[model samples]
Target: MKILVVDDDPMVLEVLKHSLAHSGYDDVTVAQSAVEASQIIAKANPAFECFLLDMSMPEIEGDDLCYWVRQLPQYASTPILMVTALANKRDIDRAFAAGASDYITKPIDMSDFGMRIQQIDRKNSQNAFKAPASISLLDKQDQEPDRIDFSKPVHLGEITGEVDLASLENYLLQLSRKGIEGLSAFAFTIADAAKFHFVCTTEEYLDILKSTGQIISDHLAASGFFLSYAGSGSFVGVGQNANLHHDEWEKTERSIQEALAKVAVPSSLGLPSKIQVFSGVPLRLNGKYAERSLDILYRTIVEAEDRCGDTSWAQV
Candidate 1:
């Protein structure tokens, strides 16, 4: 993970480079101006994982530089840190509006700087997010266990990890991040994660699903989306944010058409497959949509066999 330090002051730049090096981050790049920073960013390909920008540069003010960084495809999602002496609320808001992820008021307190770096490093860790505690379900007789509760928050980042082909057990453990309810619109493609049989067997795939379900509730938190699963290949997710009314459903159908046409799935098993997404409003609970707010993603295997055409696979 590379960190780009952008500031016009040569002495400040040198100090930052030296300080960060002392702090054990070796891949630091310094840029004297926003123009130079942009050039470095472009040539750096893959982009820097994080950026620390000095807000007082004349070539491009820090806030403006942040805005430009947000405009670039590679840096749009990258974590950006703004360094400034300005502690005004208005300036902080502007930095956020300009797409800065976090800000540091300068005069560079070494202790605070170290703490901020630690915080960002934690966020960057794949396992930083933790799943919420398990809720107890009551039984039919209201005795021990069996009653279900469906109200809870869903956090996506918790379960995602670096995918590895050599480890199936670890991969499944990582997938515990997703609650069963959130996967209602889910679809996946087998990637042969353990290299089992080159193409995963249905039984083995079912085992993986069953094991993951033990961790969280199955079925989605809400309804109105279709799900498909790919085992061992590539997982795809699709979601619909539409209504059942004729007009809304038609719009959703059109959206699916465009999504299917434009959606690009990765090449797997030497074949090109695309995921399909359909959207619809889940059944109203107290007249409101719930935590499954983001569109669910679906993965595809064969085109015709797994195409999520114009219908809901199962209602929530």
Candidate 2:
């Protein structure tokens, strides 16, 4: 595939080009700025198949450039992956909102990059064979339910084997009362739960959920955190010394993605499964609002879910 990579850092550009080349992507073009990328796009007879953009760039930022590329008729649905060092939730939200298909944080992991590209290729291949009418039909069928039944009780052991939602909330309340430092809550959900349920057997779907919960539990447990299944595919985690550092969060996110990617379903399922993880760190814990820790945690998870579409992550 013809790929265009845009980045201002010479080292990053070289490393990415070398990595892509090593991965057998020979028709790779490098651009130092968005302006240069635009020029390349304008002059090409056959358009680039995919884009790797640096989120932070001179002239036009990657997110803005992604938006601009989507505006072009030829590139509207082309995969545009954001390659950047910005790992915060806000940056991720902006990138996706502005039309990024996927994102990779810097100091790139070439193996992960290859897997992501392969996924995009598989999706594009699947899409290429689909008729427009059928595509429309599937899109309509996948529309989210107007009301989700979050009140449904989930057997905690059947899912993540962690504590129930009420227990998690009580833990958070106790921590708040004791004046915990560096407390952070994280929420995770299976992004393609609707489709998974429609396609896979109940046993298979539950297995996937169990694996997902274990992955999250294992990762958080290393940091001495507590995790719980919050029903409707949502999992919440509370950590006292999460430190709220961007690098730490990025590492955790990468671990989650790696674990999820290993999960295999039938190719007939025709869609990639994904997990959406959101981190909520309260910036203030003073005065009357301090007593409402559970409320804050719930709101943060809700905000994270609202900000992230299917197969994405965000922080609030």
Candidate 3:
């Protein structure tokens, strides 16, 4: 696959290029600035398949460059991985919001980076072989209005790479049946999500959803949480008591906010937009709610949405 690596740092550029070459990607191109990258892209015979961009640069920020790259018709759906030293949630969110497909924080982990590139390569290969019927179906879905029907359960594939609510419900049910306790569930919703549909294409909105899911999953991964899309720009996450404490939950909320802040609506849309999240009170998986865990979770999501008038997060 043809790859493009752009970074102001000479050492980083060299290292990335060498590593990729060693891994058999000999068609890799290197750029020191956004202008250079643009020129290279314009002249390339076959376009680059993937881009690895540094978030911090001299003149044009990597995020801005990413946005510019996304505007190019041929590269709209191509993978752009942000490689940077900004490991904070806000920076990561900005990268994704600017249209990055994935992120890698520096000091670079060559092994992990290699694995991510391989995964992208595999996905591209798979997509190249998609049946015409499948493509047509996806095209049809894209033409439809961007609305989520909460009455019916959405397949896991329809949203981000999170498990379905049914899966989370089944696990909770099993835990209840085994008399295990100390599990808690929380619901999350994206504030003013409908406005996104009005401003962004279906594909862009879906990217926002997937990025939001990834932010939540990364924060809750260490706590052994089960996160699933709860329909209509909402998510449900279940975690143990240790991870559901007031302090931990607060940290998670902050992370979510930082990530969402970068997901902005286009200025051309002529509408003020922001990516605010509303989270409900943690519902302990005990007492009367044990048997109706999924129901309780869904209700909590509704409650959170209702209470998220002008706030980043809602408590209970």
Top-TM-score structure, candidate number = 3
Per-residue CA lDDT of model 2 for 118-145, tens digit only, reads: 8777767775754321011123466532
Best by lDDT: 3
Q: What stretches of model 2 exceed 4 Å from their correct place? A: 131-316
Residue 196 lDDT (model 3): 59
lDDT of 1: 0.47
lDDT tens digits by residue: candidate 1, 187-253: 2222222332223343332333333322112223323322222332233333223233547544544
Ranking by lDDT: 3, 2, 1
Residue pairs with backbone overlap in model 3: none
Q: Once superposed on the true structure, which residue ranges of model 3 sit more than 4 Å away at CA?
A: 131-316
At residue 53, candidate 3 shows an lDDT of 98
Model 2 quality (TM-score): 0.44
For residues 87-119, could you state the per-residue lDDT of candidate 3 as single tens digits?
654565466546667777788889988988898
Report the error of model 3 at residue 260, Å: 22
TM-score of each: 0.42, 0.44, 0.49
